[model samples]
Target: MPLADAGLTAWSWNPLTDIQVMWSYPFMVNAFRAGAVIAVLSAAVGWFVVLRRQTFAAHTLAVVGFPGASGAVLVGVASGYGYFAFCLAAAVVIAMLPGAGQGHGEESALIGTVQAFLLACGFLFVALYKGFLGGVDALLFGSFLGIGDGQVVLLAVVAVVVLAVLAAVGRPLLFASVDPSVAAARALPVRALSVVFLVLLGAATAEASQITGSLLVFALLVMPPATAQLLSPRAAVSLPLGMLIGLAVTWLGLTAAYYSPYPVGFFVTTFAFAAYVLARAARTAATAFGARGPRPGTGATGGTPHAVEEAAA
Candidate 1:
């Protein structure tokens, strides 16, 4: 059945029919596949990103790629690869910056400076090759309908490499993130780890930018991990759970966008935002109503033997 016959139209009331329709199309299948890969990678890296307080860096990388991708399109180059390369280079430079903390204002200042220059270069490239404007726009905003088999394979490869690196260094990364002073004292190669993680983050951002658009990649990367933190601060439990949530939101967003008039990026972002809000609310409620007791050895309710004996005897 063709996508049209399967109810890909915006007005389709039967979700089952819409899903059937979308599944029948190879492009839609590939889009969802790509989304799943991006989601997993984003969530995993994002967990560390939140722990390290690098949300600004993630957001900056997403936006900075806009000009690189646009410039590639204008110059008749492979825009995806160009954007990835540019982002990786930028990540290296940012990681190398001297002792500058990842403060929001400072990060934003650096990112804004880089973004302004890239945007200008992007515009210049577009002007030199006016015919490719539509292609550039599509890359910037995203077009799930345009994703091909080649892009899917590229995303898969990137995802696999990133996950492998993340797993290999997972323990040290956590240690450094939670308590850098102790990690450094142990001579754990903290700086090298930070550099490596930033590179991997750059790769993840590049992959996510393809599906979520450069502007909204942060939605999937930052939001899901932040949400997971709210629900459970323990890295052991929250890490895997966060990835699951990210994957679920991506799949849901893609499905919803396939049948609705809205763009896929919009749906994906909306789902991420909603998840964050819901998780925060649950956390707040739990904190308000959950367990509470006096300190041990300081009160009648303390867990001392006398208290236990008095209560029981």
Candidate 2:
């Protein structure tokens, strides 16, 4: 049998055509447009998230998004209002919570408490609604099935504003992240930078929730940047490359969800997880192979041995 006829999927055989066909649907266009924007924004904000080691804060901001939408539903307002309001408010509160002299344990306890409180409130809001919260699952797990042009436009606008801020503060933020003490010594406003970045992170988390939902934000916000960082630590290469990977994953997920009977979030999370696993495997393999060979001045009777001897002496 011909390879194309051997039970090959339409996408694998003619990927571009399949994508064009998917794009024919207006809903899919909205999904792709929103997904692409969200993916890039998440990657950009998320890289610093990884650099700053603030995964818990990111997770809390995402969880807070649930209550934001649910409360909006209860109040007869657009869900976007709740998402941004709640997430941004939480970011501010977390930033204001004095970190000075607080032990890691205490800070974690505070963050965890906030998450628990927000989650409890989210459930309460859902339960108190008079009628069934239609598409509640979609709000929780994310859905691109009915994404509208308005949503796409809002996402683009927010992305522009957020990215502009990121560009303006990227260098100082990097310095602060790498060495807070030195940055502070250099009068870099370390605490202020931390707060500003957290606010950006919260915004990114809320934006990502629109696509991946509050429940599984790591699909885009964490995984793509994490995988990219593994591939390269330099921000210049990894940051943009991570955004590319995120866009690819979002497109693939949207395409797969269009054809399958599953939610977009599931496909998106799966793709991101797969990418992370593949990156880990490749890095492991490279390390294993790279370790097998010795350096030019390494192994017995070389610069490496002489250096060791000198250190010992």
| lDDT digits (tens) for residues 145-215 of candidate 2 | 65788878988999899999999999999999999999999999999999899889888988999888898
The prediction achieving the highest lDDT against the true structure is: 2
Off by over 4 Å in 2: 1-17, 100-104, 107-110, 130-134, 292-313
Question: What TM-score number comes out for model 2?
Answer: 0.85
lDDT for each residue of candidate 1 in 1-313, tens digit (9 for 90 to 100)? 1343556455477878867876888988998898888899999999999999998788778776777777777667766776688778878887898553365555667657767777777667766776766655556656577678887898899889889999999999999988999999999999999999999988988887887878788778899888877765456667787788899988988887776666778888898899888766655544443325333223333232233333333
